[model samples]
Target: MKLYDFPLSGHAHRAHLFLSLIDVDFELVAVDLASGEHKKPPFLALNPFGQVPVLEDDGFIVPDSIAIMVYVAKKYGKTDWLPEDPQQAAQIQRWLSVAAGQIAYGPCAARLVTVFGADFNANEVIARAHSILTLIDAELANRDWLVTNRATIADIALYSYIVQAPEGNVDISFYHDVAKWLRQIEALPGFVPFPTSKAGLRAIS
Candidate 1:
């Protein structure tokens, strides 16, 4: 298996983290986003959207991080990470949608503004980040994981961006349960951290 990754991308990190946690042996192919490599023809063939963390297992391709996680879980028969129950699957899917929607426009967009200089209203995105985080904090107040008793793709989907949210100037200190949840993920076996940017360091300081 091969994963096309960019080190600084939380989206990419999500795929990488899940694969590592499952002990899947996959080769990492670095995509040089700095040099417009992701926008080029070769990479574009893998994902027309020009995104990183596209998985290539044999000749089959899986694009998007959440899609990659689902593919890996299903393909590898690691149902523990992704259960087969209908209601459980639906709940996990709900958080996955949050990860793509709120989490994207919230924490992800905020980080883009700081780390990549993307043109986005910092205040708006940071506010959105806090709003969703507030909900997540409450949801996690009585549980160790998001969906089931154990960690699932739901937790993995939300992990990357929330942990690095401070980089986007969204203060996470007040969310006590959220902070503890981040540590729980970090303590997982074969866990890999998302690389912190200089902007993230400054924001936390």
Candidate 2:
């Protein structure tokens, strides 16, 4: 498999991280977002939306980072990342939705403003970051994993942006449970961290 990736994208990080966790041997093809290579014909042939983290397994192309995680897990990882129970499956889907919506609009959008100079309302995104973080913090208060006894795709789905959120001026210092939860993910085997930018509201100890 060849993973077309951009180092700075948290979306890309999720795919890369999960592949590593599953011990899949794949090649990395760096996509130059700076030069708009993703929007070009060759890349667009892989994903119409021109997104990075597109996985090419043989001739099969899978777009979207979260989708890549799901595909890899279903084909290779199985019960390790996804479970059999209907309730657990539903819970995982819930967090994946949060990752796509709240986390994307909140921490991810906020970081985009600083890291990529994206035009977004920093105050609004940061506030949304906190609102979502508070909920995640509460949920994590009694558990290490997001939806199960061990780590799942749901945890991996939310891991990158939430951990890097402080870089977008979203302070995470007050979310004690969230902070501890971040540490737990870091301690996992085969864990890969998202690159932290120097900008944003870093948590103060």
Q: Per-residue CA lDDT of candidate 2, range 1-205, in tens?
A: 9999999999999999999888889999999999999999999999999888899999999999999999999897478689878999999999999999999999999999988899999899989999999999999989988998988999999989988887898878889998888888888878887876677665332
Candidate 2 lDDT (Cα, whole model)? 0.90
lDDT of 1 by residue, 15-113 (tens): 999999999899999999999999999999999999998999999999999999999999999889999999999999999999999999999999999
Candidate 2, run of 10 with poorest lDDT: 196-205
Winner by lDDT: 1
> Which candidate number has the best TM-score?
1
Off by over 4 Å in 2: 202-205
Against the hidden reference, what TM-scores do the models get? 0.98, 0.96
Give the lDDT of residue 195 in candidate 1: 91
Instruction: Write down the lDDT of every candidate, Cα atoms only.
Output: 0.95, 0.90
